[model samples]
Target: MSAREPSYFAKCACGKFCAELYGEPFLMGGANCYCNDCVAACYYCDDKARKEGKTNISMRCADYQGAGAAISCWLLDNLRITSGKDQLRGFKMSAKSPLCRTYTACCCTPMIYIGQKFAPRWRAFNLNCVTRASDGQPLKPTEMSNVMGDFALKEAWDQIPAGQPKYKMIPWGLFPKVLAVIFLPFLFPGSTVKVLEEDRAVPGMFIDAAMVTEVVSAETYVAAGVRVPKALLEDKKGK
Candidate 1:
Protein backbone atom coordinates (compact mmCIF):
# COMPACT_ATOMS: atom_id res chain seq x y z
CA MET A 1 0.00 0.00 0.00
CA SER A 2 1.17 3.52 -0.76
CA ALA A 3 1.78 5.82 2.23
CA ARG A 4 -0.82 8.56 1.92
CA GLU A 5 -0.16 10.42 5.18
CA PRO A 6 0.72 14.10 4.64
CA SER A 7 3.31 15.94 6.71
CA TYR A 8 2.15 18.83 8.84
CA PHE A 9 5.61 20.44 8.69
CA ALA A 10 5.92 20.54 4.90
CA LYS A 11 5.38 24.17 3.94
CA CYS A 12 5.91 23.86 0.19
CA ALA A 13 3.93 21.76 -2.26
CA CYS A 14 5.76 20.76 -5.43
CA GLY A 15 3.58 21.23 -8.53
CA LYS A 16 2.04 18.16 -10.08
CA PHE A 17 3.21 16.78 -13.48
CA CYS A 18 -0.04 17.36 -15.35
CA ALA A 19 0.73 19.52 -18.41
CA GLU A 20 -2.78 20.94 -18.56
CA LEU A 21 -2.69 21.87 -14.89
CA TYR A 22 0.75 23.44 -15.11
CA GLY A 23 1.74 25.53 -18.14
CA GLU A 24 5.19 27.09 -18.75
CA PRO A 25 7.79 26.77 -15.95
CA PHE A 26 6.51 23.26 -15.61
CA LEU A 27 8.34 23.28 -12.26
CA MET A 28 8.79 19.67 -11.10
CA GLY A 29 6.90 16.39 -10.91
CA GLY A 30 6.51 14.07 -7.89
CA ALA A 31 6.94 10.29 -7.63
CA ASN A 32 6.72 7.36 -5.24
CA CYS A 33 9.93 5.36 -5.72
CA TYR A 34 10.54 1.90 -4.17
CA CYS A 35 13.71 0.96 -6.03
CA ASN A 36 16.62 -0.59 -4.14
CA ASP A 37 18.69 2.51 -4.76
CA CYS A 38 16.13 4.74 -3.03
CA VAL A 39 15.96 2.37 -0.09
CA ALA A 40 19.70 2.04 0.46
CA ALA A 41 20.34 5.74 -0.14
CA CYS A 42 17.85 6.46 2.63
CA TYR A 43 19.31 4.03 5.12
CA TYR A 44 23.05 3.90 4.64
CA CYS A 45 25.30 6.71 3.28
CA ASP A 46 25.49 8.10 6.80
CA ASP A 47 29.17 8.97 6.99
CA LYS A 48 28.36 11.71 9.49
CA ALA A 49 26.45 9.44 11.86
CA ARG A 50 28.96 6.65 11.37
CA LYS A 51 31.83 8.96 12.21
CA GLU A 52 29.98 10.53 15.14
CA GLY A 53 28.99 7.08 16.45
CA LYS A 54 25.36 8.15 16.88
CA THR A 55 23.17 5.06 16.83
CA ASN A 56 19.41 4.68 17.39
CA ILE A 57 18.73 7.11 14.59
CA SER A 58 15.34 7.91 13.07
CA MET A 59 15.29 9.30 9.53
CA ARG A 60 12.38 10.44 7.29
CA CYS A 61 13.39 9.24 3.81
CA ALA A 62 10.84 8.90 1.00
CA ASP A 63 10.60 5.11 1.20
CA TYR A 64 9.63 5.15 4.88
CA GLN A 65 6.14 6.05 3.66
CA GLY A 66 4.04 3.15 2.40
CA ALA A 67 4.04 4.39 -1.23
CA GLY A 68 7.71 5.44 -1.29
CA ALA A 69 6.99 8.51 -3.46
CA ALA A 70 9.01 11.73 -3.24
CA ILE A 71 8.47 15.15 -4.75
CA SER A 72 10.72 16.24 -7.63
CA CYS A 73 11.81 19.88 -7.64
CA TRP A 74 14.79 22.06 -8.51
CA LEU A 75 16.89 22.63 -5.39
CA LEU A 76 18.39 25.76 -6.93
CA ASP A 77 15.09 27.65 -6.96
CA ASN A 78 12.32 25.47 -5.55
CA LEU A 79 13.98 24.82 -2.14
CA ARG A 80 13.76 27.80 0.17
CA ILE A 81 15.94 26.33 2.98
CA THR A 82 13.61 27.38 5.80
CA SER A 83 15.67 25.79 8.58
CA GLY A 84 18.26 23.10 9.27
CA LYS A 85 20.37 25.08 6.85
CA ASP A 86 23.62 23.77 8.30
CA GLN A 87 22.52 20.21 8.99
CA LEU A 88 21.95 19.24 5.33
CA ARG A 89 24.10 16.39 3.99
CA GLY A 90 24.21 14.43 0.71
CA PHE A 91 25.26 11.07 -0.71
CA LYS A 92 24.94 8.88 -3.85
CA MET A 93 24.53 5.15 -4.54
CA SER A 94 28.02 5.05 -6.03
CA ALA A 95 30.73 7.34 -7.29
CA LYS A 96 30.00 6.76 -11.00
CA SER A 97 26.51 8.35 -10.87
CA PRO A 98 26.15 11.70 -9.16
CA LEU A 99 22.54 11.22 -8.07
CA CYS A 100 23.09 12.76 -4.64
CA ARG A 101 20.37 12.58 -1.99
CA THR A 102 20.21 14.90 1.03
CA TYR A 103 19.45 14.36 4.74
CA THR A 104 19.88 16.28 7.94
CA ALA A 105 23.19 15.06 9.37
CA CYS A 106 22.32 16.42 12.80
CA CYS A 107 19.09 14.47 13.29
CA CYS A 108 19.44 11.95 10.49
CA THR A 109 16.41 13.36 8.65
CA PRO A 110 16.50 12.17 5.04
CA MET A 111 15.01 15.12 3.19
CA ILE A 112 15.82 15.15 -0.55
CA TYR A 113 17.54 13.20 -3.32
CA ILE A 114 19.19 14.91 -6.31
CA GLY A 115 20.74 13.25 -9.31
CA GLN A 116 21.43 13.29 -13.07
CA LYS A 117 20.91 9.57 -13.62
CA PHE A 118 18.19 10.08 -16.23
CA ALA A 119 17.57 13.79 -16.36
CA PRO A 120 19.75 16.76 -15.61
CA ARG A 121 19.73 17.90 -11.95
CA TRP A 122 16.84 15.75 -10.75
CA ARG A 123 15.86 17.14 -7.33
CA ALA A 124 13.63 14.60 -5.59
CA PHE A 125 12.66 16.01 -2.22
CA ASN A 126 11.14 13.83 0.48
CA LEU A 127 7.39 14.21 -0.10
CA ASN A 128 6.98 13.69 3.64
CA CYS A 129 8.34 17.19 3.83
CA VAL A 130 5.80 18.35 1.26
CA THR A 131 2.52 19.98 2.30
CA ARG A 132 -0.14 21.90 0.44
CA ALA A 133 0.89 25.53 -0.10
CA SER A 134 -2.45 27.08 0.86
CA ASP A 135 -4.09 26.55 4.29
CA GLY A 136 -1.08 24.41 5.31
CA GLN A 137 -3.04 21.34 4.36
CA PRO A 138 -1.57 17.85 4.63
CA LEU A 139 -1.42 15.31 1.77
CA LYS A 140 -1.76 11.57 2.00
CA PRO A 141 1.17 10.35 -0.13
CA THR A 142 -0.15 6.78 -0.41
CA GLU A 143 -3.62 7.99 -1.35
CA MET A 144 -1.98 10.12 -4.07
CA SER A 145 -1.03 6.89 -5.93
CA ASN A 146 2.43 5.68 -6.81
CA VAL A 147 4.01 7.06 -9.99
CA MET A 148 7.65 5.88 -10.25
CA GLY A 149 7.82 2.71 -8.17
CA ASP A 150 5.08 0.20 -7.43
CA PHE A 151 3.95 -1.44 -4.20
CA ALA A 152 3.69 -4.95 -5.70
CA LEU A 153 7.46 -5.13 -6.11
CA LYS A 154 8.69 -3.94 -2.73
CA GLU A 155 12.26 -5.28 -2.75
CA ALA A 156 12.32 -6.33 -6.43
CA TRP A 157 12.36 -3.64 -9.14
CA ASP A 158 11.07 -5.54 -12.19
CA GLN A 159 7.76 -3.66 -12.10
CA ILE A 160 9.32 -0.18 -12.04
CA PRO A 161 8.23 2.55 -14.44
CA ALA A 162 9.26 2.09 -18.08
CA GLY A 163 10.28 5.49 -19.36
CA GLN A 164 13.44 7.08 -20.84
CA PRO A 165 15.80 5.49 -18.30
CA LYS A 166 13.45 2.52 -17.89
CA TYR A 167 12.88 3.70 -14.31
CA LYS A 168 11.44 7.22 -14.46
CA MET A 169 9.55 9.58 -16.79
CA ILE A 170 11.68 12.66 -17.37
CA PRO A 171 10.18 15.86 -18.67
CA TRP A 172 12.17 16.48 -21.86
CA GLY A 173 11.66 20.23 -21.61
CA LEU A 174 13.64 20.30 -18.32
CA PHE A 175 16.59 18.67 -20.09
CA PRO A 176 18.32 21.94 -20.97
CA LYS A 177 18.95 22.97 -17.36
CA VAL A 178 19.48 19.39 -16.13
CA LEU A 179 22.28 18.80 -18.60
CA ALA A 180 23.78 22.21 -17.94
CA VAL A 181 24.45 21.35 -14.25
CA ILE A 182 27.37 19.21 -15.35
CA PHE A 183 29.04 22.16 -17.11
CA LEU A 184 28.97 24.29 -13.97
CA PRO A 185 32.16 24.09 -11.91
CA PHE A 186 32.13 21.36 -9.26
CA LEU A 187 32.26 24.10 -6.61
CA PHE A 188 30.15 26.81 -8.17
CA PRO A 189 29.61 30.08 -6.31
CA GLY A 190 26.75 30.00 -3.73
CA SER A 191 26.54 26.20 -3.97
CA THR A 192 26.15 24.49 -0.56
CA VAL A 193 28.02 21.44 -1.89
CA LYS A 194 31.41 20.15 -0.82
CA VAL A 195 33.08 18.01 -3.48
CA LEU A 196 34.68 14.76 -2.23
CA GLU A 197 36.53 12.43 -4.62
CA GLU A 198 36.42 8.65 -4.42
CA ASP A 199 39.70 6.82 -3.81
CA ARG A 200 39.01 3.90 -6.15
CA ALA A 201 40.51 4.62 -9.53
CA VAL A 202 37.84 4.71 -12.28
CA PRO A 203 40.32 5.96 -14.89
CA GLY A 204 38.33 8.56 -16.91
CA MET A 205 35.08 7.84 -15.12
CA PHE A 206 33.36 10.37 -12.85
CA ILE A 207 34.20 9.36 -9.25
CA ASP A 208 33.74 12.69 -7.53
CA ALA A 209 31.22 12.95 -4.65
CA ALA A 210 29.69 16.30 -3.70
CA MET A 211 29.20 16.38 0.09
CA VAL A 212 28.03 19.27 2.25
CA THR A 213 30.89 21.01 4.09
CA GLU A 214 29.11 23.41 6.45
CA VAL A 215 25.80 24.98 7.46
CA VAL A 216 25.84 28.83 7.47
CA SER A 217 22.80 29.49 9.65
CA ALA A 218 23.11 28.41 13.29
CA GLU A 219 19.96 29.91 14.72
CA THR A 220 17.96 26.66 14.40
CA TYR A 221 18.58 23.34 12.75
CA VAL A 222 15.17 21.93 11.72
CA ALA A 223 11.65 23.31 11.65
CA ALA A 224 9.03 21.49 13.81
CA GLY A 225 11.68 18.85 14.46
CA VAL A 226 15.22 19.23 15.79
CA ARG A 227 16.10 22.49 17.44
CA VAL A 228 19.29 24.20 18.53
CA PRO A 229 20.12 25.09 22.14
CA LYS A 230 19.06 28.44 23.55
CA ALA A 231 22.70 29.25 24.29
CA LEU A 232 23.62 28.55 20.66
CA LEU A 233 20.66 30.57 19.40
CA GLU A 234 21.56 33.39 21.74
CA ASP A 235 25.18 33.26 20.61
CA LYS A 236 24.11 33.54 16.99
CA LYS A 237 21.79 36.39 17.89
CA GLY A 238 24.64 38.17 19.65
CA LYS A 239 26.77 37.86 16.55
Candidate 2:
Protein backbone atom coordinates (compact mmCIF):
# COMPACT_ATOMS: atom_id res chain seq x y z
CA MET A 1 0.00 0.00 0.00
CA SER A 2 1.16 3.54 -0.77
CA ALA A 3 1.63 6.18 1.91
CA ARG A 4 -1.48 7.97 0.74
CA GLU A 5 -3.73 4.94 0.24
CA PRO A 6 -5.49 3.85 3.44
CA SER A 7 -6.57 0.24 4.09
CA TYR A 8 -8.52 -1.84 6.62
CA PHE A 9 -8.53 -5.56 7.52
CA ALA A 10 -11.40 -8.09 7.36
CA LYS A 11 -11.71 -11.85 7.22
CA CYS A 12 -14.03 -14.84 7.39
CA ALA A 13 -14.16 -17.69 9.91
CA CYS A 14 -11.50 -20.46 10.01
CA GLY A 15 -8.93 -18.31 8.19
CA LYS A 16 -10.45 -19.40 4.92
CA PHE A 17 -11.72 -15.90 4.22
CA CYS A 18 -9.76 -12.69 4.65
CA ALA A 19 -8.98 -9.52 2.69
CA GLU A 20 -7.83 -5.94 2.85
CA LEU A 21 -10.69 -3.80 1.59
CA TYR A 22 -9.13 -0.83 -0.18
CA GLY A 23 -10.82 2.52 -0.57
CA GLU A 24 -11.21 5.79 1.27
CA PRO A 25 -12.01 4.75 4.87
CA PHE A 26 -15.65 5.21 5.83
CA LEU A 27 -16.34 6.67 2.37
CA MET A 28 -18.76 3.85 1.65
CA GLY A 29 -22.28 4.20 2.95
CA GLY A 30 -23.67 1.46 5.26
CA ALA A 31 -27.00 -0.31 5.51
CA ASN A 32 -28.64 -3.28 7.22
CA CYS A 33 -30.24 -5.53 4.62
CA TYR A 34 -33.28 -7.53 5.68
CA CYS A 35 -33.99 -8.22 2.03
CA ASN A 36 -34.68 -11.86 1.27
CA ASP A 37 -32.13 -11.58 -1.52
CA CYS A 38 -29.50 -10.54 1.00
CA VAL A 39 -30.58 -13.23 3.43
CA ALA A 40 -30.53 -15.86 0.68
CA ALA A 41 -27.11 -14.69 -0.42
CA CYS A 42 -25.81 -15.13 3.09
CA TYR A 43 -26.86 -18.75 2.98
CA TYR A 44 -25.89 -19.39 -0.65
CA CYS A 45 -22.49 -20.86 0.11
CA ASP A 46 -23.82 -23.23 2.74
CA ASP A 47 -26.52 -24.32 0.36
CA LYS A 48 -23.96 -24.93 -2.38
CA ALA A 49 -21.69 -26.92 -0.07
CA ARG A 50 -24.54 -29.21 0.88
CA LYS A 51 -25.56 -29.74 -2.73
CA GLU A 52 -22.04 -30.33 -4.06
CA GLY A 53 -20.89 -32.58 -1.15
CA LYS A 54 -17.46 -30.96 -1.09
CA THR A 55 -15.01 -31.34 1.79
CA ASN A 56 -14.79 -28.14 3.88
CA ILE A 57 -14.13 -26.82 7.33
CA SER A 58 -16.78 -26.52 10.00
CA MET A 59 -19.51 -23.92 9.68
CA ARG A 60 -17.91 -21.24 11.82
CA CYS A 61 -18.19 -17.79 10.21
CA ALA A 62 -21.55 -19.21 9.24
CA ASP A 63 -24.67 -17.40 8.16
CA TYR A 64 -25.35 -13.66 8.32
CA GLN A 65 -25.08 -14.25 12.08
CA GLY A 66 -28.61 -13.66 13.14
CA ALA A 67 -30.35 -10.27 13.61
CA GLY A 68 -28.73 -6.81 13.48
CA ALA A 69 -26.08 -7.90 11.01
CA ALA A 70 -25.76 -4.78 8.91
CA ILE A 71 -23.24 -4.90 6.06
CA SER A 72 -20.90 -1.93 5.77
CA CYS A 73 -18.93 -2.05 2.55
CA TRP A 74 -17.42 -0.13 -0.34
CA LEU A 75 -17.80 -1.08 -3.98
CA LEU A 76 -17.81 -4.86 -4.61
CA ASP A 77 -14.75 -4.61 -6.91
CA ASN A 78 -12.79 -2.94 -4.12
CA LEU A 79 -12.46 -6.12 -2.03
CA ARG A 80 -9.10 -7.82 -2.69
CA ILE A 81 -9.23 -11.36 -1.44
CA THR A 82 -5.95 -12.03 0.37
CA SER A 83 -6.44 -15.81 0.34
CA GLY A 84 -8.83 -18.57 -0.59
CA LYS A 85 -9.99 -16.84 -3.76
CA ASP A 86 -10.89 -20.27 -5.08
CA GLN A 87 -13.25 -20.56 -2.14
CA LEU A 88 -15.06 -17.42 -3.26
CA ARG A 89 -18.34 -17.92 -5.02
CA GLY A 90 -21.56 -15.95 -5.48
CA PHE A 91 -25.05 -16.43 -6.83
CA LYS A 92 -28.00 -14.20 -7.56
CA MET A 93 -30.73 -14.36 -4.92
CA SER A 94 -33.13 -14.36 -7.79
CA ALA A 95 -32.72 -14.07 -11.52
CA LYS A 96 -33.85 -10.44 -11.36
CA SER A 97 -32.12 -9.48 -8.11
CA PRO A 98 -29.25 -7.02 -8.60
CA LEU A 99 -27.01 -8.20 -5.77
CA CYS A 100 -24.60 -11.04 -6.63
CA ARG A 101 -24.61 -12.78 -3.23
CA THR A 102 -20.87 -13.42 -2.74
CA TYR A 103 -19.12 -15.71 -0.29
CA THR A 104 -16.31 -18.26 0.02
CA ALA A 105 -16.31 -21.79 -1.37
CA CYS A 106 -14.40 -23.06 1.67
CA CYS A 107 -17.29 -22.25 3.99
CA CYS A 108 -20.56 -20.40 4.14
CA THR A 109 -19.20 -17.15 5.39
CA PRO A 110 -21.33 -14.30 4.17
CA MET A 111 -18.86 -11.93 2.58
CA ILE A 112 -19.65 -9.17 0.08
CA TYR A 113 -22.58 -8.40 -2.15
CA ILE A 114 -21.61 -7.42 -5.69
CA GLY A 115 -23.69 -5.94 -8.45
CA GLN A 116 -24.02 -7.87 -11.67
CA LYS A 117 -26.33 -5.60 -13.67
CA PHE A 118 -26.85 -2.40 -11.70
CA ALA A 119 -25.65 -0.46 -8.65
CA PRO A 120 -22.08 -1.12 -9.67
CA ARG A 121 -20.79 1.80 -7.65
CA TRP A 122 -21.55 0.21 -4.28
CA ARG A 123 -20.22 -2.99 -2.64
CA ALA A 124 -22.13 -4.38 0.33
CA PHE A 125 -19.71 -6.04 2.77
CA ASN A 126 -21.35 -8.36 5.25
CA LEU A 127 -20.86 -6.52 8.50
CA ASN A 128 -21.19 -9.85 10.24
CA CYS A 129 -17.96 -11.11 8.65
CA VAL A 130 -15.83 -7.95 8.97
CA THR A 131 -13.17 -8.36 11.64
CA ARG A 132 -11.07 -5.69 13.37
CA ALA A 133 -8.13 -4.01 11.69
CA SER A 134 -4.58 -4.57 12.98
CA ASP A 135 -5.06 -1.38 14.94
CA GLY A 136 -8.15 -3.01 16.53
CA GLN A 137 -10.58 -0.68 14.84
CA PRO A 138 -13.62 -1.47 12.72
CA LEU A 139 -13.53 -1.20 8.95
CA LYS A 140 -16.24 0.98 7.48
CA PRO A 141 -18.60 0.42 10.41
CA THR A 142 -22.18 1.31 9.65
CA GLU A 143 -23.80 4.42 11.00
CA MET A 144 -27.01 2.36 11.10
CA SER A 145 -28.58 -0.73 9.59
CA ASN A 146 -31.10 -0.19 6.81
CA VAL A 147 -34.04 -2.55 7.09
CA MET A 148 -35.07 -3.56 3.58
CA GLY A 149 -37.29 -6.01 1.70
CA ASP A 150 -41.04 -6.23 1.65
CA PHE A 151 -41.01 -8.74 4.49
CA ALA A 152 -38.78 -8.81 7.60
CA LEU A 153 -39.17 -10.32 11.04
CA LYS A 154 -40.66 -7.78 13.41
CA GLU A 155 -38.10 -8.74 16.03
CA ALA A 156 -35.30 -8.08 13.58
CA TRP A 157 -36.61 -4.58 12.91
CA ASP A 158 -36.37 -3.78 16.60
CA GLN A 159 -32.60 -4.18 16.50
CA ILE A 160 -31.98 -1.18 14.25
CA PRO A 161 -29.57 1.37 15.63
CA ALA A 162 -31.36 3.95 17.69
CA GLY A 163 -29.69 6.85 15.87
CA GLN A 164 -28.57 5.43 12.53
CA PRO A 165 -30.23 5.54 9.12
CA LYS A 166 -32.88 2.87 8.70
CA TYR A 167 -34.73 2.35 5.45
CA LYS A 168 -37.97 0.49 4.99
CA MET A 169 -36.49 -0.90 1.77
CA ILE A 170 -33.79 -0.27 -0.79
CA PRO A 171 -32.88 3.01 -2.49
CA TRP A 172 -35.28 4.84 -4.80
CA GLY A 173 -33.38 3.83 -7.97
CA LEU A 174 -34.20 0.14 -7.45
CA PHE A 175 -37.95 0.57 -7.64
CA PRO A 176 -38.01 1.12 -11.39
CA LYS A 177 -35.87 -1.90 -12.13
CA VAL A 178 -37.98 -4.08 -9.83
CA LEU A 179 -41.17 -2.75 -11.39
CA ALA A 180 -39.95 -3.45 -14.89
CA VAL A 181 -39.19 -7.03 -13.95
CA ILE A 182 -42.53 -7.38 -12.27
CA PHE A 183 -44.56 -5.96 -15.13
CA LEU A 184 -42.43 -6.85 -18.13
CA PRO A 185 -44.14 -10.21 -18.57
CA PHE A 186 -47.58 -8.69 -18.28
CA LEU A 187 -46.75 -5.80 -20.58
CA PHE A 188 -45.45 -8.21 -23.21
CA PRO A 189 -46.98 -11.64 -22.91
CA GLY A 190 -44.74 -14.67 -23.64
CA SER A 191 -41.66 -12.48 -23.09
CA THR A 192 -38.61 -14.51 -22.24
CA VAL A 193 -36.90 -14.17 -18.86
CA LYS A 194 -33.98 -11.75 -18.77
CA VAL A 195 -30.63 -13.35 -17.96
CA LEU A 196 -27.22 -11.81 -17.44
CA GLU A 197 -25.05 -12.07 -20.55
CA GLU A 198 -21.87 -12.71 -18.53
CA ASP A 199 -23.22 -15.70 -16.60
CA ARG A 200 -21.04 -18.22 -18.47
CA ALA A 201 -18.05 -19.61 -16.57
CA VAL A 202 -14.70 -18.37 -17.81
CA PRO A 203 -11.56 -20.44 -18.44
CA GLY A 204 -9.07 -21.38 -15.65
CA MET A 205 -11.77 -21.96 -13.05
CA PHE A 206 -11.80 -25.29 -11.19
CA ILE A 207 -15.20 -26.92 -11.16
CA ASP A 208 -14.55 -28.93 -8.02
CA ALA A 209 -12.45 -28.71 -4.86
CA ALA A 210 -10.90 -32.16 -5.52
CA MET A 211 -9.36 -30.70 -8.66
CA VAL A 212 -7.14 -28.39 -6.53
CA THR A 213 -4.11 -29.88 -4.73
CA GLU A 214 -2.36 -26.76 -3.42
CA VAL A 215 -2.17 -26.45 0.35
CA VAL A 216 -3.77 -23.25 1.70
CA SER A 217 -2.69 -21.92 5.08
CA ALA A 218 -4.41 -19.05 6.87
CA GLU A 219 -1.03 -17.47 7.71
CA THR A 220 0.10 -17.48 4.10
CA TYR A 221 -3.40 -16.25 3.38
CA VAL A 222 -2.70 -12.69 4.50
CA ALA A 223 0.34 -11.94 2.35
CA ALA A 224 -1.04 -13.65 -0.75
CA GLY A 225 -2.87 -10.53 -1.90
CA VAL A 226 -2.90 -7.06 -0.34
CA ARG A 227 -0.53 -6.41 2.56
CA VAL A 228 -1.97 -6.39 6.07
CA PRO A 229 -0.33 -5.82 9.44
CA LYS A 230 0.91 -8.76 11.53
CA ALA A 231 -1.30 -7.74 14.45
CA LEU A 232 -4.46 -8.95 12.71
CA LEU A 233 -4.24 -12.73 12.32
CA GLU A 234 -6.93 -14.91 10.84
CA ASP A 235 -10.10 -14.83 12.96
CA LYS A 236 -9.63 -18.47 13.97
CA LYS A 237 -5.90 -18.75 14.76
CA GLY A 238 -5.33 -22.50 14.20
CA LYS A 239 -8.64 -23.70 12.88
- lDDT for every model? 0.39, 0.47
**RMSD versus native structure for model 1:** 15.6
TM per prediction: 0.44, 0.53
> Model 1 scores what on Cα lDDT?
0.39
Kindly report which residue stretches of model 2 are placed more than 4 angstroms away from their true locations once superposed.
1-6, 25-29, 43-69, 76-78, 95-98, 140-142, 149-151, 158-164, 170-239
For model 1, the stretches where C-alpha displacement exceeds 4 angstroms are 1-29, 45-69, 115-122, 139-239
Candidate 2 structure quality by residue, lDDT tens digits, 1-239 = 65322266556656676666766423324566664444434344444556777433322222323233356655434555566655556554322233345556665565655443333334456665565555745544534446563444455455555875556776665467546654666688776343333322310121222222322223332322222223223434534
- Cα lDDT of model 2 overall? 0.47
* Clashes found in each candidate (C-alpha, N, C closer than 3 A): 12, 5
